[model samples]
Target: MTNSENSSGSILQWLGFRGARGGRSVDGKPAFANGAGNVFQQARRHLLDEIAAFLLTYELDVTPNNLLTAHGAFSGSNPALARKIAQHVTAGLAVTQEWLDEITAADETIDKHDGIQHLMARLETTLESFSKNANDTRSATADYTDELEQHVAELDQVQGTGQILSSLADLAKAMLERTRKLETDMRRSEEEAKALRRSLEKARREAEIDHMTGLPNRRAFEAVLEREYRDARASFDPLTVAFCDIDHFKRINDTHGHDAGDRVIRLIAEMLATISDDNCHVARHGGEEFVMLFRGISLSEAHKKLDGLREQMAERRLRNRKTDEPLGQITFSAGIADVFDFSDPRAALKAADEALYTAKQGGRNQVIIAPKGGAQAA
Candidate 1:
């Protein structure tokens, strides 16, 4: 009885359907009045049904995050999300809650700066202990030799059996000399051990770092991960872990050569370093890949920080130094996971890797967050 009815009548009359409230089709099925409002309702109903079917197809929950995600994918408003879902489908991957949560949020993870420093400090302490023990052993042997000589001299002064005293002196002198030689040998051995220890220490420190980028290497990152996990738990502070890989790195190497690729790798490392701080840590995970850790920050905040770095890198167009060839915009894909969300650091790391895989498949250069069931930081 209002404009709504009038609009319905207009739309219905245009379609040659009689009346606005109740109508029937050629097949004898009850139909809409064919009004614009009725048409919208029909499409809305269908869209909701499709969303429900999608949730059922993947056994996804109807939580707000999931619901909005499903709507975005099916409603065609978010083409990127739709494109990512299509990629997952094409790859035959299960449309999972974790994957959906990750892609929808879009983020990264954490690494603490002090983790490797802790390892190096502990190693230095151990080396120092060994050095101290070797010196102590040498000093004690020298003093014992001196005391033995004094005892033998006192025995010589006593009016004892001449041959017995002489024999005792001779044996004492031999024992003293041998002890002295042992002390000398101990000193030499200690010196050589110290030298070897220094070399070993140097090698170990180097091993923990990427020579090209001077960032901690993959081995170092694992140590950092363990320590950061423990510290974050103890402090009840938030921690995040992330895996990053340069997008299309292989193409760069193939097209521009390894030298240029190496330059690109260093550039990426330097950019990552710009964000490194007491709370944020970065490392060179391996060839064209890196790892990050964040402490005392929420997942969303950490994601913003890392995403900033990602965007900054993408905005820059680089050129090959040697050949002066334009390399276009260089970018990387990243995956972030909340450390406390998982039972352990390894589990979080695995989740981050899975997220990283999705980011790559979702058309690289974006940060993705791997969301497991939520948990308190502790």
Candidate 2:
């Protein structure tokens, strides 16, 4: 018998189905007896009914190989039937592989990266037109002023007729009124333009900053780190990084609920922003963690600044809103490392993480410094 048939037959036997020709009845009928045929027929019928139910429910495609494998695995206990099922499974997998290849090829034909460039070019053109319009508006206002002045000079030089002088005065007043309306319209237009520009800038800034903390997010932090690293390399200025982790953050969440946890995070974020220098860029790395980049500062200096911030945080008295009782103080563990020695921002972060792990291991509320090329402290 073929391998596929053998596999299917074994599967059928394992599933408690008897073969058609070799079935020995449980009532002690001879192996090759005609009475065994009746039992095998009943088993085959039941098995086929199950296969039909499965196919109907699953809505499987009625391929010849699938049908044969399904039939053999359900009713036949022969080794050859089992082998056929295995071969059919392999063929089915090959078909799926071909389908995936076709889909991927079709996708690759249409996928391109030119849309972003086109959009940027279009934005630039729009900005240029806006600028030109502004210049044109300014020139038009100046030209109108010059014409009004010429009109005034003409009025002064006119013949001594009171009616003509009065008529000219009325015409000049109407012209001035029209000019004032135009100026008001122009101011409104300029205000709209300024509003649009501010909206775009606000969107860009929001994209780089964390929504909850109002600090730089991970993407912005990475960009700033690269910039700082380049600056440090060129000027040989000291650059340090501090990896800060809030202590027992999970415990706080479990004990006081996520609302309290969020409040604590926001409070810490505000305190960090207030304590850090303007040059220092603080970012919410992710979930109860923060990163601080100190430009032109030594590791010791960074540690001192972080230490003070930690103390300030620990001293703050946060209370339960309903009970008026203390909710317990929040503390953070920090790790400090120099940015100059690390090859990449991630490496510097890893150094700081190592130090943070050390701090956590030692106790939970202390700062640990990872030196340039030394073992982590405990």
Candidate 3:
């Protein structure tokens, strides 16, 4: 067969359709569907247009990060979830832009303040020089007056008096100019310093936030966990740690796509965030895993909380939009361990991980509690 014929066959195989050769349509024209002239080209153009529209509609920039994020959003089983992820990405971009603005403001404010300091330093130096000059002028005037007294001569004393008066007037004019400049420089510096302080505050707040889900990231979680653990240790209160994993998460990715997997992750993250409060901390621990720190809660209370979350997840039914097919039950398994039960807080985390592993093995949808001292799951 010719190259064009071979190409036509490949397109037919890809689309899972076979077209008859040398076929005629009802209109007595060459049937494009039958592997005939420019049909493949037309289809290719249409597909490209559709892809371009998808990219434009989602505002998905053709960069690696954006492309990955968009892929995750669109490949998901549900359109609603895709839209949520898109909105979330947009909000994240906005926050990032806000941070850039604050940092920029900080840069400008620091530069402005630095300029003011330079001006003030210059003014101070000028004032000091003017003061020395004034002192010298006074000393000269005193000497001139004394000379006039000592020499009792008419022309010499009169000339010395004229010179002393002229020096004093010049000194006063220079001092006045320096004082005004110093005042202006000081006021401008104070204003810029205030602006710098505000930017610093914004930076601190944004630092703790996770760029993906707007929840506290792992770093923030660790900070809170350490402080809470210490406080709980001192007060002899219970502190529980739960390690959560999305069950068969890899299967979701394999079946639907990574974007679909991402949707599931975001959904669970949002649910965790919504259920958490000031006393409790929830954080993504990379991939389809999460960690929750429950301060001042007993083992049973922590277990109950996580199990409740698992049940909520069990109730959710995610579906594929294109195929109108169910993606099956989405669930998470959790392992909870109380920090007070162990000598080391790190041991508690190990216990939680162990429990999580057990939960995963024990049929993949339950909360398992690990005993103290990294013992077997309770």
Candidate 4:
């Protein structure tokens, strides 16, 4: 057989049809074979044209190009169909190259295009019917390319969404951590403030209290006296001062040790504190002496209060447990002076002291009142 005959047979076999041979005509050419070959060629041309038209309408560029090259040499004596297919294939290729160029030049435009699946569906139907002899190959290739591109685009979209979610999670975590730290700092500051307040309160208490007897000390007494003095000056209210000394306190300390003497002093301080009212303030002045400030009271009233306190002290017995003996029954000499006659605390105190001296001379355990504008008398 000639190469042309072999090639024709190959094309028929590719289309799944049998090539036929017939007896020679009177002109010595194969007469019946030529007619059959013409019929087969026409059918092939019809199928190619349908496929090419579909590819052009739907923009399947790559599969048509492959089909054109595969069947170009065998599509004989029908150069018109071959040229038509070639033109369509070229057009699709040009369109594809332009599309790729457009995508590269302006990526934002691609985002606005129909999604991958929609674009691929149009392409698949067009490219898959390009060759009647190899329809299965063309269809399979189009389907594979379409599905693959769609999968890739979907994966890209998923990845983009994942990135956005990750960034939001990071931002939320950062805000939570910041809020936690702020709360921790506030708690720490609150605790520090409470500690500082407690320290300040303790210091103020220490400043106001006497260390030895646990009563108001001389400084606190003076503060109260000054306030009472101002109020009396303004309202013309009566104010009085009483100075009292423990009788023979030095002898008591010399007889019983100083420890017993301290105990005796503490006992006397407790008794005085109990006997005094809110209008009166009692304080340990020094050594064995104590001072009382009275507001809105008379000299006669002061005399009665001091006398009662003295009798109470004399009746109480203080004894040392170690010695198992009486430390002593305590007694005090008291002097009262009116603040109306004195301009300052010192003058009042001096007047009261003179009265106390008289009381001591007259015999201890007594109340002495300074006669208005006169010396103190027991």
Candidate 5:
């Protein structure tokens, strides 16, 4: 077969379709069945059930993006992501929207979606223009007030002026007072707009960051990946991406309670951060997972470094200071892939994630390197 034909066949699996097109997706029926009056309610119901399960399971907010996210996880492409979520379900770990956002962050779509960021940006632009116009109008009104005051003075200077002059003076005073009020209102409106613009900026920054770890969240990482991918490919520099998961973290939470679990999570964050530098970027990718991006690094070299960290972590035993209860050895498993080897960064990320699963299945506390340029890393 031609390369195109091979790619077409492989895309079916990559896109979570089984057997052939217009057929099973993820499970039994096709995902996203054809619309335009097609008899596909059974498939529709199945997909709805999957969406509902995700919302109800995690108590996630009912939003269109959340619905789409869940659908993609359970019914659409990336069944591996669905499987990973199932593991969390089995472990009884708390699920957060942040976690879902992180793991599914590999969707290689551009930021063309109509979202709050675009909305806020438009609002800011409008407000800035409005504020400038308001200030300009205020300044013009102030100059007009000065002109009005001079006219009133000229009327007073007229010798032996009658009642007409008195009426003109009264009218001029009224106009002056009204102009002052207009200036004050315009100034107030400008200040309010400036304040709102500042708030929007702050909100935008917060949305891209993880509140728990104060690190770049999945949404932020997605932007980073896109930029780094371009820079890496252009410069012909090797870029490595890895996914890491804390081994038996839910057990830690279950045995020692959430407080201890929080500490363990923080400790892992710190340990991972030690490896971060200008060439390496690390972030908490939601829940018990962290993602790292490395530029100018080889795959096996990155693995050697991360694997060494894993061994050190495995050798250390922790304890809960609250009750002084002993906690078993804490360690993390990692899966890594070189970005240039894959057709795209998203494929590389999925491959790395599959390797992470191998590390887990092969017994945790180790790092696995995926085969070059393949979808199934392990």
Candidate 6:
């Protein structure tokens, strides 16, 4: 038998099912096979059925990327990868739910930011008014003091008690009016300062969140990473960082449109959030990429977690709801490195990037751990 025929037979034998050979169905569809055919023909039919089932179940488009991703997930030796694929396939639903929550929170934050910006502007205007009024009050007070001193001096030289008393009363009334105006300005200024303090707090929160994914943005991530790195070094604690990138993300954008691409980004972000815990921090490193920080975890532990996540990502079949077309499987490659192994944070990130490069080169949907020493500059 030919290699194809031999392979077919082996697969059929492994499945414990015979192949069908004799009949044609009325619809011109080959009669459903019930175990009778040449090994090659049976194998081809079985493969076709499996492919159809996969497409139907996942609502995936019959694209080359989807085919390859599905084949890897179904038959790959690593069970973790397969399970991960399954997780990815199911991630779309989870993404939808998680996105709603994030969008709601995001909307609330945006509103607060808007409100604070308005308040800050008003406070700025009020403070300016207060500054002007305080200057005016000081000048008025100086003029009033001079007038009172001159009136008293005049009163001492004059012969009438009524004139001196009248001047004294007028001076007292003028000083009391100036004191009340100053007090009002001071109170208004104090309230404006309080509002400004609140606005600053809101501004800080707005700065830290990524507008697209609602995850911590790179700037915030860097601050947290630096602090953690410093603490880990001092205490000799386990700290690991992973760099992750989506496979064929540009192709997805080109093929499915930008809206679909956005969905993919949000999906991945939600997935990361779902998998993370209090000890694990997740951030969007930028377009189609992410970074994860695992505190109190060694390189091996981080590797295991990321590998599973990678597998899950591979299994996810992204689709465009508008066209009802499968966008194809979403897969990622990742690299993990121990923080303490590197001399600095940048070096650690570089090593993780190199390991990620290796993973992508090896295959588009796996994880690789960075070498112990560190990664060389690319």
Best by lDDT: 1
> What lDDT is obtained when candidate 5 is compared to the true structure?
0.77
Query: Candidate 5, residues 102-210: lDDT per residue as tens digits?
Result: 7656442323343567878999999999999999988879858877787768677666657657767777787889899999999999998999999998899899888
lDDT of 4 by residue, 1-378 (tens): 223323432432322221112223456433344455577775665445433433444354656443453244234543433343334334444424454334333433443374566678877865665555377766768857875675456445555677767755765676689889989999989999999999989887788777778887778888888898898889987889988899999988888889888887888788888866778889988888888988778878878888898999899887876687887678999888998887687788789888988899999899898866656665
Which model is ahead, 3 or 4, in terms of TM-score? Answer: 3
* Per-prediction tally of clashes: 10, 22, 2, 0, 0, 13
In model 1, where do residues sit more than 4 Å from their true spots? 1-181, 373-378
lDDT of 1 at 322: 84
Error of 5 at 128 (Å): 46
Residue 98 in model 6: lDDT = 45
- Clashes (candidate 3): 2
TM-score of each: 0.52, 0.47, 0.52, 0.51, 0.54, 0.56
Model 3: how far residue 272 lies from native, Å: 1.3
The model with the greatest TM-score is 6
Question: What lDDT does the true structure give each of the candidates?
Answer: 0.79, 0.73, 0.70, 0.69, 0.77, 0.73
Which portions of model 6 show Cα errors greater than 4 Å?
Answer: 1-171, 375-378
List model 3 lDDT by residue over 121-169, tens digit each: 9999999999999999888798578655644453344457777577557
> Residue 34 CA error for candidate 3 (Å)?
99
Rank by TM-score (best first) = 6, 5, 3, 1, 4, 2
**Which digits, one per residue and each the tens of the lDDT, describe model 6 over residues 224-341?**
8999888888988899999999889999989889999998999888888886786789999999999999988877888888888777877877669889899878988888888788
lDDT winner between 1 and 5, please give it. 1
lDDT of 3: 0.70
- Report the C-alpha displacement of residue 297, candidate 2, in angstroms: 1.8
